[model samples]
Target: MPTTSTGSKSNPARHDMSVILVTGSYDHEIRFWEAWSGICSRTIARTGESGQVNRLAISNDKRFLGAAIHKKIHIYDIGSASSDPILVLDKHTNNVTSIAFNSEGQWLASGSEDSTIRIWDLRSPGNIVHRTYENGAPVNDVIVHPNQGELISCDQAGSIKQWELTDNLCSHELTPAGDVPIRSISLASDGSCLVAGNNKGQCYVWKVNDESTSLPRFQAVTRFLAHNKYLTRCLLSPDAKYLATCSADTTVKIWSISPGYDFKQEKILVGHQRWVWDCAFSADSAYLVTASSDHTARLWEMASGETVRQYNGHHKAAVCCALHDGAS
Candidate 1:
């Protein structure tokens, strides 16, 4: 993990090269912030047919920021002075719901409401899509396994499908909770656990086992109701120590990951005025950043359960945020 700069928090001009935090909103703009200071350093207008930003992802190498808007994915240069996007991937027919980068940062993976998942090769000059997989249902989330050999995706039909990277085939299909729509999915960075959350505020857990198979198998662990309202997003800490779930109830709940996969509620982050849409864990897994419909994003300390910094520049609802604080 990288340590944040020891500079003054009120200094807006001092930018720390170690940390990068950005937020996208219905306000039709993306703001780059000084994470420790809560200062908006740069603002890029996201206008035209791209529509509102639905999700945001930072490449592992911290070279680019991928924004999923409407039916297109815009890639922006993070270290450059220009505000223009260097590349735009326009292949999805419907809204691009989720986006992520591979561990090497050589490729990008995205899932869409068009019922497909596409892998874009970042090293190619023509911006070629390496491959595409049809999910048969609107995909809500897709994540690359830590082993870099597979992809796991959850859809509106309440199905979790595991795709094998080597053979390009679906190896496992799991319907954890009947036919309810699955809103989000998260995998532990160490490949120890898999979690999926649904519209009914339920969360299901599974342990990743690699016994006698080339593809990792999911052993059922447990399921619990994490929220009373809609569960908007679920994310696992990079260290696999905590699970964070954002809800329409305007709170983010953190669950402690026990040794035996017994997850228990550790804290409930209160303060957001409206729906808590998205959140990201610091590389050290000690802090959290949350975006809300209240048009603000806040940084919270896990142990203290208090807001350490508040980012309040968005004109409309802040829907998504991306953070990269350490090298992969």
Candidate 2:
């Protein structure tokens, strides 16, 4: 709601109650900003030896910040600017690319360039409960389902694997017919369906039925050729009414899904200067945030399809980003 200048880089994190946490990249710090006012309430910076931060995830309670660097996961106690991480997870041999905290905040999931996914128990430092590997492709993203005891992982090969945390084994694999490399996968809040975008500039939605035990498969309910280039990211709105996708074609499209049976496309959101890497909807589904290779993140009004605010200034391409409400 608050207005700011373009060319400013801020890593945004959403809290439980919908408040947003905004952090500045390249400047080497994090800031807690009031979502509506856009005012900085707190500032934390790297103090010791760590330099640049690539990705960030706040704990469920918003008390801790988990940052991914080249090869380590640094856990920082919020409000403390000290350079030291309360816990340093070094299980990934390659760079830690992404991290996420479960709804309970009891477990942390991390994916890395090593083509593996690791789940860690927050109660026990350095205790990794599960470590699973893909044949060779790097694990690009991992997300914990809202209600189910499952985690979904996507890799460079465009394959999506669902792992049951309780058993710590892959329960299902959703592979496209053409084997197009999947860029991102997000589950609807109801846990009944999943939407995935691939490098082929196509997006597919799968209905997850629990009955089939043979091979984990999904019936493709809807397909959208939204971009001419690779589709980099896909996000489902909180209400599950809308799905937003970003692509290498330098545009973002919003699709409306019919309520009960058939999931169909309804609209398109088009605005961006270059390839869009990531896109997310506000908690209310009224606004959208997009990060692009042009080194800027723009906020879009969902209803009107207008560019509201732009956050720029990253020295290099902006790869991944999120919006935080600040309750944590």
Best by TM-score: 1
State which candidate has the highest lDDT.
Answer: 1
Residue 210 miss distance in model 2 (angstroms) = 3.3
How many clashes does each candidate structure show, in the order listed?
A: 0, 16
Residue 23 shift from truth in candidate 1, angstroms? 0.7
Report every candidate's CA lDDT.
0.91, 0.70
lDDT of 1 by residue, 1-328 (tens): 2465564568634678678899999887899988877889898885564499999999888889999988989899999877788988988999999998998888889999999999999888776889999999999999999889899999999999999989999999899988999999999888889999999999999998884777558988899999999999999998998999999999999999898888899999999999999999999898899999999999999989999999999999999999888764
Q: What is the lDDT of residue 13 in candidate 2?
A: 40
Candidate 1's TM-score: 0.95
Q: Each candidate's root-mean-square deviation in Å? A: 2.2, 5.4
